[model samples]
Structures are given as structure tokens and as C-alpha cells.
Target: MRQRLAFALGYLRNPRHVGAIAPASRALAQAILAEVLRNDAQVLIEVGAGTGAITRALMPALDRLDRFLVIERDPGFARMLSAHFPELEVLNCCASSVDQLPLDASAPVTLVSSLPLLSMPKAEVQKCVSAMLSLMTHRPGSKLIQYTYAAPHLRPFANIPYGWRWRRVVSIWANLPPATVWSLEQTPRGASIVH
Candidate 1:
């Protein structure tokens, strides 16, 4: 509780850096990360991994051979993440600069972001999303999982090209304000959007 309050206060003071008030609940964090792992994505990029609520759940789901890249802008949180999950390659950088990170091109990338997209400017949000999509190797089943405290359809990735489709995997009312997990998939050319 104290940590959550501190996070909230920090965010209130600096909205751009401290995206969200509280860390995700264990159940919601696990559920969100599980959707990405279920698709067998070899490389996973986690954005805004504040204090590593989802990171903790993500590590166990991945195999020893798999790689996890965690991007966090807050140095304090990044240091905490490094201390907690030394196995992961934690990058103290913004999500928009994801492409600049040293990632393995051979592996399929699946981006899972907890960044508060709605709170940020549209341009910044689009850039971050685009960067994530561009980083993917574009295999048969590459995906991006994003969780938000809003209705699934309401939070549109509008800047994304029509070739991509978003699906609501699950919703967790157990979370503080409740959150919906949305999976972004690239549809085949000329194929209808997948619900």
C-alpha cells in the first residue's frame, strides 16, 4: 500500500515518467503476460515495467532459451527491476526508443506494454506503438498484448494500419480500477479483421 501511494504521488508530480499509480494486480498481470507467451513468441519486450509486477509473472512462463527485454524510463524503478530480476535485460529507456535497443532479429517479438497511452499525447503513443510493431520480425503469429483500464474497443490503436487487428482476451475486475487485456494481431493481406 505504501509503495502504491508513493507511485501515485510520483505519477501525480510527473505524469510523463511515472505513468500509472499502482502496480498491476498479480492476477491481471499474469493474465496479460500469459496471452503473449501462449502464442509461443520467442522474444518478449515489456514497456513501462514499473517495479516489475508483470515481469515477475512473465519470467516463470518463459523457457530458459527465451529472452525478455524490459524497458523502463524511471531510473529508480529500473534499478529496482534490475535488483529483482537480474536475469532479464532491463533497459532504462523510453518505449518510443525501443527500436534502438539491441534485440535479436532472429527471434519473433511480442510487445507487452503497461504504459498509460491515454494519458500521453497521441503522437507519442503512436510512435511507441509503431516502434513496437516495427521491431517484430513479422512471422505467422506475432502479437502485441496491451492492458488498459478502459473498455476494449474504446482504446483504439487508430494509427495502426488496417492490416492489424485487436482482440480482447480477458478483463480483470479484481484489479483496482479493472483492466482489459487486448491482443494485437496482424491479419493476412485481403483478409477480414479478426474479432
Candidate 2:
């Protein structure tokens, strides 16, 4: 399929970022969006949205008041998403630069990501995760949905910030390499905001 070929090409271009040769399965897409469906959030922001795999699943849930932002660092993938999914407002930028966006703090937001966290350098991974956590603090109760090929038993890195805990864990066997989806929420109290 077109998606499979595009994904393969992207992976070939940058294996560290793309992390997989095939696009996510519809089952994985559906599972990711299901978390958004369960929440009443009106704003959705997706990071590393390669080829709009998850953006397509988010379409039905969008309304006039809703804001869906898809961020991709690759220009080729950004263009593809813009051309194919005209409804999405795709931002061609790195996930680490998300803090620069003029995101509304008061609005409820749901963040879904396909970023290859496990493969990224520890510092880069921490930067992106910290930026997202900063956003969540502004929009209390905001949730972050991320998928990894790693199993649930694989613990988070020791350096990861505290005050964020998993709300749900789903094993998606239908994906190319199989993945586990982690739905996360900030803890009610406080954890020193990491910069």
C-alpha cells in the first residue's frame, strides 16, 4: 500500500526517527483514538505524526471548536500529510520544539504521539517528554498517549520525571512489530517541573 511504501522510505531515510518499516495498523490507530474518545477534551495535538497514520483516525472526532495539530519534523512527511489530510493543520517542526506553539492552556488537550522514544538519545528523549509535561501542567487532567514496541514489563528510564503515571496500557498485537500503548496523566499533586 501507499502508506507502507512511504513508511518504508521514511524508515530508510532515518531509521532512528522512523523506527519502523510499516505504517501503524488500523487497529493501532483505532486504539490510540479510543483514548481521545473516552475523554471530553476538545483539543488534540499529535507529535511525530508521520504520514498522518493517527490523524486519519482522529478525523471523525473533530468538530468546529476542536483544534487538531499534527507536528512532524520531516518536510516530506509533512507535505504528504498536508496534501492528503487537508483537514489537518500540520506543523513542520520537531517534537522538542512543541513549547513554541501558541497552545491554549485552559483548553482540555489530548496529546498523542508516534515518536520513537526508545531509540532516541536519552537527552533528546527527556527534552521532548519534559516539553509535553510542561504543557500538561497548564491544561490540568490532560492525557498523553504514546506507543512503544517494548512490552509493558519494560520499565521507564530512571531519569524520567515523576508526577506522571500511566492511566492505561494496551497491547496492540495487530501492528507490524506489535506495540504497547501507554495512556498517561499528570499526578494530582506536584512533581518539580523539569526544564
Candidate 3:
């Protein structure tokens, strides 16, 4: 399809950023969507939404959302996302600036990320990870959904915040190279890594 072709071209341009040769599979998208709908989120923010694969899957959540934001570092992909999803606001910026966004402090947020964190530069990843954690800290009950191509047993972060934890949602064998989804959120007691 045209969408997949565009995604492939984007991947070819920057494999490190695009992170995959093909767009996320429907099964993977469904898995993510299922997690998104598990709880009501006031704000929906997606980072590194390459060619809007997960973005399209997130459309159903729009009806109940207060705001929907798509962050794509690549300008071309940002424009394509904007064009394909005119209903949402697509920002062309690094995920490191996530804390700079004008998000509500009281409203809970759900951040869906497709960024190649492990593949990106260490400094960039640190900045992004710190900012994301800060953003979630400011907005209580906020959760982050991130999928990775790493091993099944690996946690998103080896050491998370003291009160936050990462929960494995599902593993998508259907996807190219496969992927594992993890949700990071504040635990009632303290931080713990659960597989």
C-alpha cells in the first residue's frame, strides 16, 4: 500500500530513527490500542510516530481524548502524519522536549512511544527519558506505553524512578523482528520491574 511504501522510504532514509524496515503490524497496533483503552487518558501523546502506523490505531481514542499529539522528529514524516491525520496536532520535534509541551498538570496523560531509544545516541536518550519521566511525574496517574525490539525479558529501563514500575503488556511475534510492549507508571508503593 501507499502508506507502507512511504514508511519503507522513511526507514531507508534513516533506519536508526525509523527503527523498522516496515511499519508496525496490525496485531502490534491492536495490542497497543488495547493497552491504551484499558484506562481513560485525558491527554494522548505519541512520540516517534513513523508514518502514523500506531497513529492510525490510536484514532479511536480521539473521541474521548481532550488532546491528541503526534511527535515525529523527521520533518517529512511529520508532514505526512499531519496530512494523513488532519484531526490531530503533529509536532516536528525531538522527544527530549516533551516536558516543554503545554500539558495539563491535573489531567492524566498517556504517552505512546515508538522511538528507537536503544539505538539513538546516549545523550539524546537520556534527555528524552528524563523529560518523559518529569512530564509523567508532574501529571499524576500518567502512564507511558513503549514498545521495543529487544529481548523479551528485558525491561524498558533497568533502573526506573523510586516509585515507578514497568509492566510488560504483550509481545508481538507478528511484527517484523518482533516487539515487546511495556507500560511505565507510578506504583502505589514503589518502583519494581515486572515481566
User: Which one wins on lDDT?
Assistant: 3
How many residue pairs clash per model?
Answer: 0, 0, 0
Query: lDDT by residue for model 1 over 23-51, one digit each (tens)?
Result: 78998987976686577777788898887
Weakest 10 consecutive residues, lDDT, candidate 3?
186-195
Per-candidate local distance difference test: 0.77, 0.80, 0.88
Task: Give the lDDT of residue 157 in candidate 3.
Answer: 68
lDDT measured at residue 117 in model 2 versus the true structure, 0 to 100? 88
Error of 2 at 162 (Å): 4.9
Model 2 segments more than 4 A misplaced: 155-163, 187-195
**Candidate 2 has which clashing residue pairs, if any?**
none
TM-scores for every predicted model: 0.87, 0.89, 0.94
Off by over 4 Å in 1: 1-6, 137-140, 188-191
Q: Give the best candidate by TM-score.
A: 3
Ranking the candidates on TM-score from highest down gives 3, 2, 1
Candidate 2 lDDT by residue in tens digits, 1-195 = 888888888888888988776888899999987777877887888999998888898788887337888999888999999998887789998888776678775776788989988887778888888888777767776888888888765533334346666644688887988888877776557554331
Which residue pairs show backbone clashes in model 3?
A: none
Which stretches of model 3 miss by more than 4 angstroms?
A: 189-195
For candidate 1, the per-residue lDDT at 101 reads: 71
